[model samples]
Target chain A: MSLDKEKIKHVAKLARISVDEAKVASLTKDLNSIFKFIEQLNELNTDKVEPLTSILNQSLRSRKDEISDGKIREKILQNSPKKNEEFFVVPKVVE
Target chain B: MSNITNLSLSEILKSIKSKKISSLELTQAYIKNIENAKKLNAFVTTTFDQALENAKKFDNKPNNEQLLSGVPLAVKDLFCTENVKTTAGSNILNNFIPSYESTVTKNLWNNGAFLLGKLNCDEFAMGSSNETSFFGNVINPVGDHLVPGGSSGGSSSALAADLTPATIGTDTGGSIRQPASFTGTVGFKPTYGLCSRWGIVAFASSLDQAGPMTKTVNDCSIMLEAMSGFDDKDSTSINKKKETYSKNLKDNIKGLKIGIPKEYRVDNMPKEIDELWEKGKKILKDLGAQLIDISLPHTKYALPTYYIVAPAEASSNLARYDGVRYGYRSQKGKDLIEMYENTRSEGFGDEVKRRILIGTYVLSSGYYDAYYLKAQKVRQLIKKDFDDSFTKVDAILTPSTPSSAFKIGEKTNDPVSMYLNDIFTVPVNLAGLPALSLPAGLDKKGYPLGLQLIGKALDEQKILNIGYAFEKNCGYKNEIKKWWS
Candidate 1:
């Protein structure tokens, strides 16, 4: 149940968080402790129990598919870290 | 004028309507109080000038019809305020401002409350103590070195210190109530979806609920009235006519059945907290209510279930924060993937990064059924426990926290110990029920201890009324000395 340094690095990569090699030992220790704490859930018998999908137990409300509001692309892009001409600028994705 | 800041929201409304005080005068008084109390580090962003401008506008064209009536209030930084920098107490969003307002803040403004500022919180509302805030940890005004409970720590601290007339905070687990209990204020978490989550920085979407942290239960009722409603934007919002909690608030709970959940009496609970629970039961009994012993067998599993479910959802919700959209961007990355990794690692604090990692680990392909799905089933059992108890009693009562506030840095290194702070409060969130915490008495250290009243889904008025009765009879008042100023 304990995560090793390799697993910690793999999870970090999946989470898109960078973990330095120097810190992996401590991360492994911390994540292992948290996982150990979470292991107590294994004692419960939930074999026949249904997973809870919603708190209110109601169907999701839906609205008609129509254009509700638009025409303010500038406001939408106002908080972008890098943007030009109605699109956010990221490191070039295309090969 | 010196005592103007001490008035509650309802009192402030009365004063403004009767011409006994102008909105400008009240706002100035609060501004002075906030300025004098800078050592507490309760506020991340203070919009004093804008607050004063709004106050003056209210004074010029008086509106007595509004619920808040020009009261200047601060909210947890997790709420997105239009054009205001909403950091959610993380460095990644340190410079990010929302193009639109959150539905909760918008509702408050529509009911005539204006923003005083954004208060500090645990980063992304993750940690139990405010120590996780990237800006800085908020000091509880109750004592010099004591930590304000988080992630709504700043809201409770600010309200207790009279920095704002009243305030609002979101509770994913014990964020609002635990801080309120620590600071000797009143905090209420309404049923899930009672308050819209649109524009709120999501933590655990199913469990996160915004509620009031006020100086009195009456004020809590008033603030709740102004905040709760349905929004078309949030699909989960409860589409029902809003109840008038303030007007219906009554101290008479005669013939009401209250449940005393035996399972909440955790091992090694402080003597003072146990006594406080006993005292709360007695007060309710003296008020003509009947008490029944109840059991929620699955109570002990709430924390572990919460850890799994909250992180799993948080991992998915937070995936949107990759360097593509708004927020912090890395200057060190050579490629897109590296950019996201570098930006998130550098921008998020240690606690946030830890939760993200745990979330990512639990929801990974091989472990999803063992961790995430199992936790969800356990969560259903946790909810069922409450549902069975509610069928036997009108409301449930328990200690708000295991003990009083701890010193800053005391539990910072131990994440499990920090998670234990929300034991009693987390189950209510798991079940999506309403609960309120009011100061029952102070512990031996003169720190405040609170008693919680749990209610059925969407039954906020019931808990508020019970809290109203308890506050009237308990005779406990927070005698916080303004030593910070």
Candidate 2:
């Protein structure tokens, strides 16, 4: 129920966020406190209850599969931190 | 003309229509006030030039038929305004400008309302206090050094200080209502899917909703009608005929059954908040509404469930922010994985990182069943409790917050203490129901307090009507001094 330093590091890795070595202890403590508070939910029995995913009782509304609008690649790429001719630039992955 | 900024959103529209004041004059007055009240730190970005140009255009060729003709309003930065920066109060998005407009803001502009600025908020709408904002904490206009409740603190502060005629803020979990309660203004969170989420910077997909923060209940109704509608872009948007909230607003609660949930009386609740609830009930009774004692047994689990579900969704939504497409990217990373890690670490604030980590932890393979799944079931129970209570009562009444506005840095170190501030307001979001917070009285420290009205799903009119009645009978008026200037 409590998150240790190792587990905190692991969670950060899973989240793709790098945690500083010095701040790991404090982060672990904060997560543990929050989990301890969240542990109160264990008191209730939910064995047969269905998870409520959406609040609306209606089923998802569907529309025709058609392109509504497009053709503005430059506008779409305008906010990119790094981009070139028509694609976003990122650090190389494939060796 | 002397105090144009003092006019309500509704009054401003009326003046513009009657030619008593041109749109340019109204916009100028608000800009002047915003310039003088920079100490409040309410605005993250002010669009003064754009606002003035639009006001001049509106004055030259007025359109009085629109719902919000020639009105200038500020909105939370969480909403993406095309070509204008929408930070969501994070350093990662500090320089990012949107190419497309959010459905809600677009709706405002389409109805003849122009943008005044983007107000500050908790980063990705995560924190209970505005301290989580990368732009810095917004000072409550009511008092010196008082914390304006978050993540819609900027909207509440701006509205309270008359910097904006009215504003809209997104509420994932008590963001709009809590700040409104803290600032003695009116804030309403419409039913889930009542407002489109398209183009909004997502925090928690299921729980996030956009609503109005205004100086009065009438303005809240007017603004809500203007800002909410179904959009094709947001799949979750409710496809129903939009109600004329302003036109149908009536204080007729002759035989309406209002629920008084005893479970909301939490341990260690301040005496003034409890007294505020009682005063609210007395006002309803005086308005000829019957009050019934109701039990929402699962009310206590709302906050814990919220912390889990919201983060889990946030982690999934925020994964899109990795350094590839948009937003901040780390120059130090040599490879793609390292780039994402470094970017997130350097870009996000402490509170945002904490939530993302908590979200990551809950949804991890081993803990998914125990944490995320269990929390969802608890969420079901919480919603069911409201479902059962509503069969007997038309709406529910509770205090908006446990206490009035606290000093800055009072509970920032302790996250749970900060989360507890939304204990009374979070349940409404969990159930996806409508709720409004109206200033009812002041605490012993003279800070304003609010009482909430919870309505059934898609029943915003009911709550707004009850709030309208309460506003008439409570006779509470906020006397905020202009000390920040």
Candidate 3:
């Protein structure tokens, strides 16, 4: 499970983080070592075991479709780094 | 009232009710103490002026109907405070003020507790030591150079240093208990879903849980009661009535069955920690309790499993922070994708980036079944191991940490070695059980060692009872020597 620069780059791309070329070598080493540590889980025989989603053993409770919140549009927009009135200002996505 | 900050939460409540001390006086004392303990770096944001203003309102007419009327406490910055900056200890959320308060903090306010400030924590609550914080590492109050264990490091440090009477913290894989172990404070992570998680910054939504950090076990119980309840906002919040834990602190452990997990005997464990475990067993055994040897066979996989699951969830949860509606936005980036990449690249710290990468890799198409799915299935096995053991034993006893607080830079370079610090405490979180760490005794370096008592799901009262008995008989209390001052 030795992770290479290509794998690290792919994962970083998927995570939307750009790793500098200078730091890529060390980051690759760290991720490889972490994967090496995690490889021990392969030894466990989990053939029939179900993937655990919630530990509370309670099913998700659905509420009626209604707008209970959103009166604080101004307050919510106050945290935006770039904003115009109520809309969050972002770089143009569509050309 | 000279040493008002020295009094426990219960004592403070009594004094405030009896008119011996006003909320304004108590809050001002804590504000001064926070200033004095500035070197510990426990607080990320101190709301002393707001605290005083609320204290004035409380002094005018104390609300006896509320449980913690006029009590002062610090909240871990992860919990969003309305109109106040809630940094999850990351530059990403440096100026991210919440429009609404976290349900737990709201519960505290409804109980009449005043917020002293926002405490520091690891970036996104990722690291074991507080070193990953964007603010800085919180130094252990016991020794100036040592780390207060994290990611609830600030919460524990503040309580131990008397900067706050009690504090709130979240534990996703030992965040609350480990820091309490390092700082010689009491931290209780109740059953997952016992406290509402609405409005707290998400870090592993499934594993993350809110709890109390305090000077004494009784105070932890009281704070736990005040902070816990069902919230319609958080779907995971338990649908149950809140237990009056402070009133249920029965120290009589006559004929209770305590389990000692043999798998926790790791290789090259410190002699002091080993002796502390033995001492805990003896203390329980002497108090008319039976000690049973139990095997949590999947215990060895807990840390790896937690690392996999938590990061996988964190990567998904953190995807929301793409610099559009929040904290730091990169100045350079022609298009939206570049902006997202650059903003995240610069906003997150190294540890956070590492976890995100690991999560991305694990959840990737080809590797999904091998890593994430396997870890989840193993998680079930781990939980089953606890479920089987609880049928035989009333509670489990173990050392809170492998050793006492280490030097600040000791394990910073190696992430795996740092992750091993949560070994003993992570299993409890994976099982979604309640556990408390009590200051048991001092280690060889004269720093405090903690004894942890693990209980079954929603059985916080049982473990708190065990911790109460241990706290009374352990004869260990933190006597702050004012090292930070």
| Model 2 misplaced regions, further than 4 Å | none
Every model's TM-score on chain B: 0.99, 0.99, 0.99
Please give, for residues B1-485, the per-residue lDDT of candidate 1 as tens digits.
56977777888788889999998999999889999999999999999889999999999998889899888999999999998999999999998999999999999999998999999999999988799999999999999899989999899899999999899999999899999999999999999999999989999999999999998999999999999999999999999999999999999999999999999999999988989999999999999999999999999999999999998889888888876678988888888999999999989998888888989888999999999999999999999999999999999999999989999999988888899999999999999999999999999999999989999998888899999999999999879999987
Judged by whole-model lDDT over C-alpha atoms, candidate 3 comes out at: 0.91
lDDT of 2 at B122: 91
- Cα deviation at B258, candidate 1, in Å, is 0.9
Q: Which ranges of candidate 3 are over 4 A from the true structure?
A: none
> For model 1, what is the error of residue B170's alpha carbon versus the real structure, in angstroms, after optimal superposition?
0.3
Two-chain complex of model 1, DockQ on C-alpha atoms against the true structure: 0.84
| Alpha carbon lDDT of each predicted model | 0.92, 0.92, 0.91
Q: Which ten residues in a row have the lowest lDDT in candidate 3 chain B?
A: B476-485
> Per-residue lDDT for B82-157 in model 2, tens only?
9999999999998889988999999999999999999999999988779999999999999978999999999999
Interface DockQ of candidate 3: 0.87
What TM-score does chain A reach in every model?
Answer: 0.91, 0.94, 0.92
State each candidate's clash count: 0, 0, 0
The residue pairs that clash in candidate 2, if any, are none
Give model 1's TM-score versus the native structure: 0.99
Which ten contiguous residues of candidate 2 chain A have the minimum total lDDT? A52-61
User: Chain B, model 1, TM-score against the native?
Assistant: 0.99
Listed models, DockQ each? 0.84, 0.85, 0.87
